[model samples]
Target: MPHNSIPVIETKRLVLRGPEAGDYPDFRATFSSYRSRFMGGPLTPYETWMLYAAEIGHWQIRGYGMWMIHDRTTDKPLGMAGGWKPAQWPEAEIAWIIWPETAGHGYALEATHAARGYLYGRLGWEGAVSYLDPKNLDSIRLAERLGAKKDTGAQTVDGNDICYRHPSPAQLKNTQISDGIELEIAHYADPKFRPEGYALD
Candidate 1:
């Protein structure tokens, strides 16, 4: 399907969809938490909603934007993971951030892997990019696991400017990964993207 025509995606334990007005409070809470400290200072509910609305608006204008990730069972939001084209980056950036309480559960990686595949596989994009802070070990590791290279070049945006890249598959194959977890990019635009028992609030 065309990129713009893609619908919500469902994963083993999550659901990926466009942002809604209802997401403001959750997003505000997530942004204020310690997990998101590196993402810039906390934003007010209105600011959070504005940012989210802009993301949703991207789908209409750019045919791509951030997709909110939520738990399928409890219907709680984990965070957002998908394609974004912020002005600072030269190419479309693949980004994801889980709420503080939800950290270390592999949600970011899972959501990101699926989003990347959708970008390259479904959207037919030539390539994708991810700009990360080198000191943010979690994000760095996640990017590496996805086979994304470190560009070394930095461009400041939202108080951060650091390594960036579009990693090759060979790079991914060469990396050693531990057991018990595997990454898959969530494709939100696919019709089959819904997780079991998922419902929008």
Candidate 2:
């Protein structure tokens, strides 16, 4: 069996860490907003708890999960980005979401690029996928921005939503991928891999 080699991911304005038990309130608040309902339901408190629990489980079971996004300056929680592999997906999925306040600021792209770098270059994951709703123009644009192509033949995870497949060699130019993190690739490829709290420990 392989060891868990996943490292915590960070961005210029955010920290992507594994979800903890205390994230329910923020998760509930974020997920319940109108901004979030377009992609998925605005979950109830219990539902938010369950979701975070599953996210943590993803890290434990699959070695990666939806990361808890925190503000780099104030350390306030913001949103999430990382890899997900539900029982039904064909490949590991790259997922991201930002609070409404954090929207339009490029947080999603930033966190996502970093997460992809870790998953592919460090963890040796070659195939990463993303599921998007056709109606969510913002997400589609982000997918294209990240070089993900629309998968016309891809099946939806739920009864709704279309799937988008990211090109293996795709790289977003404007998004920042930090150097000082403690991951294998960060230590080797990035000069700043362990920047501040960005360390894996």
Candidate 3:
């Protein structure tokens, strides 16, 4: 494969890399369905494009954004996982989405572990949180699976968006990624793939 400007992160069975046009169709389908209710979605086509473009644009503006999660065996895009920080947010957030077909396969849980590790290891972030709608039980459970705790003191958008703070840098000082996870984050990552001026290793 050719070199990617964005760093490619590998886990046990998936590849996390930059988003592209091929990922849009699946994304649109989710955002158009009830599955997206917690994400302020069920958006119109115009709104979907805007949200999709913003996700891609976030990488340009912030140097770190969501990665398209692809199955290593099939190389087919399954979902997305990574970080996002808009201007209004108090801190960056770890985010993920597993397509309907991949639901219950533990893909989001696995992909998120890699993404969170990347944020702390390569991105040089001191902390991060995952914001979810109060009713987004799936996301809340995922956050809990990642060892995140509900941060009631954190600020939210529109007095909503329950915040789940991930394991802090100090908390994950050791045992960051799971034992079964094989990360290509450091040794195989691009030397130039620094996020916001932070080195990969």
Candidate 4:
């Protein structure tokens, strides 16, 4: 698919869409902190810029990549959440990162659930995994809540991250949008690959 045609996903409280240049400030702020320790950060400004550029490039090259998450109400960028599969990855992975101030309100869980739904429902993926740093307790907990279990046999390219395998579409349960919340998938007529009929919930 053409990069510009990347789909935008929406949920009750957030929008998961393609990365934009405007998201750089939040990206820089998040990665410049110690919170980024597990995400290859505390990077130099130039490096951060390159990382942002790489995120954009990833979508162009892989058809599916991370989405720039936004607070639907405030229309502000919150962080990123979606599928990722760099060259050396064992499988496509579901990933998320929320800005520090926005932490703990279930945004990660909400966005990730929506992203994983898109991957499985809209994209017909059998499953996905999350490469998590064992020390990142919060992520571990979130992965567990999302029904992802550590795949003891799997390893990352860097050899340090543990893989958490997510449930397949058939295993997902109770994922309906709650009252006052909406989930929208952007329409794209000529996607490189048409999705087979699959529903996450």
- On residues 6-87, what C-alpha lDDT tens digit does candidate 2 reach at each position? 4666665667777766766777777776767765667776776777778777777777777777777887777788888879
Off by over 4 Å in 4: 173-201
Best by lDDT: 4
Worst 10 residues of 3 by lDDT: 192-201
Global local distance difference test of model 1: 0.67
Tens digits of lDDT, candidate 1, 89-110 = 6667888888777765567877
Give per-residue lDDT, candidate 1, residue 38: 58
- Let me know the TM-score candidate 2 reaches against the reference structure: 0.77
Give candidate 3 misplaced runs (Cα > 4 Å): 1-4, 175-201
Better-scoring candidate (lDDT), 2 or 3 = 3
Tens-place lDDT digits, model 4, residues 1-201: 566798989887788889988889999998888879889878888988898898889998888989998888888988789988888788899999988887755677778888988989888999999999988888887787677889999777588899998877876744543211222222111244323553121
Q: Identify the superior model by lDDT, candidate 3 or candidate 4.
A: 4
State the lDDT of candidate 3 residue by residue for 103-155, as single tens digits: 76567777888888888988788878989898878888778767789999988
Candidate 2 at residue 181, lDDT? Answer: 22
Model 3: how far is 21 from its true place, Å?
0.9
Question: What is candidate 2's CA lDDT for residue 110?
Answer: 69
Give TM-scores for every candidate, taking all chains together and pairing residue i with residue i. Answer: 0.74, 0.77, 0.84, 0.84
Q: Candidates 2 and 3: which is better by TM-score?
A: 3
